[model samples]
Target chain A: MAYTQPHPRLSVVSNSSHSSVDHLSPTTTSRFSLPSVPSLHSSITTTKPGPNRPNIYDRPLNKTRSAEVSASAFAFLFSEVVQYTQKRVSGINDLERQLNTLGYRLGTRALELMVWRAEGSSKAPKRELKLLSVLMMVHTQVWKAVFGKGADALERSVENPDEYMIIDNDPLIERHISVPRDMSQLSCSSFTAGIVEAVLDGLSFPARVTSHNTPTVQYPNRTTILIKLEKSVLEREELLK
Target chain B: MAIFSLWVINKAGGLVYQRSFADGLAALTSNEYLVLAGTLHGIHAITSRLSPIGSSSGVQVIEGETFKMNILLTVTGTKFVLITSIKDPTADSVLQKVYDIYADAVMKNPFHTPEMPIRSEGFDSRIGTLIGTGQT
Candidate 1:
């Protein structure tokens, strides 16, 4: 039997006979469906305001907790970054400076993450207050975390009291990068230099850091990251001693 | 197994890089080399279309009486052609290694522009060492 008109409440209750409800006038059904429309719209709008997807800030900061990315992937990405920076800059120095600036941002983030991870560990976190200890932390902890190994050597410059150097026998970033003969002066390790500079800067040890290609007979890709502490920093170090 | 030479053709069928290992090989002028690369690229395309069962990768291994040429076409259309001795069984493996090196050295070098001639000193040295080991 055809029911041309049915109560909205009865139609909702008798969902099994949905085909009969199709015979009802479109205007009547639309009017009845209008009440549920607001609820559906409200639900969608609620989800829109606060998405179920996790934010980056909510993620764990511990390095060990995260999956390690392949070195080749990093190499490919670093290569592209260098190329992108190369196009924007004028001279090799300008390119290095720009790369250094980019690395500085990474260094700040790395420092914060490392500190957080260290605090999360079992051992009581010891604050690095002195210049020597801070340099040691960078040479050991920072290098180990970033490059998977400690720096080869850390030495104070005999000629200059304020100057120090951290030597890396083979810098990871420079492994596949071969600077052309024409631009032999350009060292990609300037990025790492920036990282070291940022770490020092963040720790309130103001210093200028620059990377130089210091190849030897044994190590072809040896890089020396020179750290030149400011006069104020040296004076503070003397007071601490 | 002795590798005679290597040629790199960009996606546009242009000769981008070439290196010769053995001495006493016939030397072609730069212009002649470009023409040779273009001819080989054209031949590969034509042969792929000529396959009986749908399209196939063309002219993979071209064997001469004394030498054999192995062509490796990457997904991006760059071709790495390695010419080795006819008796060499490891030509394909060597070609694979060459491709890996190209991806690392040439592609990774900021100084190297895509589809241009590769003049990377590191690439040259690494390729030399790789092919040199194969020769010995």
Candidate 2:
């Protein structure tokens, strides 16, 4: 279920607003209240419609259709996208950044969709409080939704508590992309890193995601996404505990 | 009637891939395959430009006595060519399915570079299975 508890401060402020109105209705002591209900109603109905707009949240995702798409269609579209983005970029880094930005937007929406989907199932969608739980969710649920399979591994840095790694033997986004020798440093998996960053950021876990080429014997395109959490988040995490 | 083979040509008219599903078609040298791909690309480009009706740059079908070739070109110029026995009606759908797999196994593969030859064993085996060939 969605987080239903209102903040303590929010309730205090709303009650004060109701009290101010209550003073005016002292003569009629029936005590009828329409305080927070109207505001909630307005927020729900405020979504405006445009002719070609498709709202992702309006209806439940079609179970069978929502999860899969023609990979060829996606590849062709992604190729054109890379080509289009490439024209304006001065270097490989810039191109990768642009692609990351594209993936970031997708990640934000995907998180919402995934959370919504999770709610429809038996398990209650939990707030990402624990670091391990969040990483597990990303490594399993998020990875599966985006790539059609779970990431191969999730591990914490032995040297640093703030650093985490999500490894995929074969990242799907890099399937067609072969970086040139000159741009060997470039990893198109940055788009996927952007997705990971956005997902963590969505849950207020500020972190940097960098994709590294870790070629294993079995997984040549083996990608390890390093997540470095912000100091503030680590501090807050400690306080929460 | 059955589908026999599939070919993928990049926008530059280079043959990136070619696979034979059935044994009747004549085998050519790898260089010959490249020439065939390049020639087809040139002809397709010229046909689109020379269309009397204008702006229709698509090559839909090419019929031979024994085989029919169906071509599906993406908006970005990647062409999928499927050759089949003349009476096979499912060539278009098969090509479309192959296109989807290409996007997945090759395009999405990080090791695969655009406009480069596909060497991914995953793509090879998937296609092999799809076309009823046990061999990858």
Candidate 3:
């Protein structure tokens, strides 16, 4: 793509034979160069073609293709993402945060697709209203649809009314990931947590989802993702319940 | 007399996958097939070592009375073997296509742990269609 420099139009008047005779002289060289004139309003204008794909806003975001992708390919790509995030950050927290941010974006789109796919040929699933119902949807339907298995368990926190827990014996995203010894405290499962958080936030439930590695003798890679709802969410839940 | 079966042996001489597409031949138990795969792997290594010239390119084909088996060893040491009727002329190319599909369907699948049994539905359906097309 050639980018033309913005230059004011130059107008030149030539005196034919008389100017031709004077053009040879050193003093007349100035005639060839146009004086720099200030452009009126300085409109640096160029036409760029509109994007080839249809405008994102103009198209409905609900369509989904029933396609399967190789899990190994996804694992390799995800590993590279972790490496890339690791290179940019100084510490584990920063890396985990970047991964969470990436997962958050994916979660927003995945939630839409999951809801559409699950609702089937009929109208979309009724907007998930109650807190417990949405949590059930995620634990059973969404988790199974995404991972090919329902999450191992879902339990409400007995100590705190606003807190909930979703447990997975083995999360698919971290199946191939073996974190180094130094970053043992770091669980990349935050990415999946971010996804859960996005789904909840999309349903208007403000919550923070964090991953905890509470491994047991049986389930070595067991993960318990804690979802802490905002104070207003509990109040609203009480009203709705 | 058509495409009969296929086997995928991992680098370590373990049978990772086996599928029979046609029925005329007698079927072996899963353990017997595993033993057969290990035996073929040993023969491949032995023959490569016994090549008179310095070149030990390994086993490429085996022709019996009724069936022909073609082998294609990938650079990564994954072996793809195709068993077909003696008349099938393009067995090598079919095995090549099988290798390509394996790379895509088995290797690329994130759920597939290395050297595990190959059970991807995509892989199975693609192979089925491929062999079906080969017959007609």
Q: For each candidate, what TM-score against the reference?
A: 0.85, 0.55, 0.50
Clashing pairs in model 2, backbone N/Cα/C closer than 3 A: A72-B100, A174-B109, A174-B110, A175-B108, A175-B109, A175-B110, A176-B107, A176-B109, A178-B113
Writing each residue's lDDT as its tens digit, candidate 1 over B1-136 gives: 6778899999889999998887535779999999989999999888888889987988999988888889999999999998888888888888899899998888877778899999987788789888884474
- Candidate RMSDs in Å, in order, are 7.4, 16.1, 14.0
- By TM-score rank, best first, the candidates go 1, 2, 3
Instruction: Record all residue pairs in model 3 with backbone atoms less than 3 Å apart, i.e. clashing.
Output: A70-B109, A71-B109, A71-B110, A72-B109, A72-B110
Candidate number of the best DockQ: 1
Give each model's whole-structure lDDT. 0.86, 0.81, 0.78
Q: Please tell me which model should have the higher DockQ, number 1 or number 2.
A: 1
Order the numbered candidates by lDDT, best leading: 1, 2, 3
Residue B53 Cα positional deviation in candidate 2, in Å, after optimal superposition:
26
* Model 3 RMSD vs true structure: 14.0
How many residue pairs of model 2 clash at the backbone? 9
- lDDT by residue for model 3 (A1-241), tens: 1333322211123445456667666444553352332232133221322455556665454442434567777777876677777778888788767877887898898888876665775564587789989999889877866677799999999999899999999888776554545677888888888888888888889899988888797765788889999998888978987
Write the residue-wise lDDT of candidate 2 on B1-136 in tens digits.
7777889999999999998888767888999989988998988988888777858866789999998889899888999898888888788788888887887777765456789887776687678878774122
| Model 1 CA deviation exceeding 4 Å by range | A1-53, A63-66, B133-136
Chain A only TM-scores, each candidate in turn: 0.77, 0.72, 0.70
Give the DockQ of candidate 3. Answer: 0.03
Q: What is the lDDT of residue A123 in candidate 3?
A: 67
Give the poorly placed runs of model 3, Cα more than 4 Å off: A1-66, A118-120, B1-136
DockQ of each: 0.68, 0.20, 0.03
Evaluate candidate 2 and give its CAPRI docking class based on DockQ.
incorrect
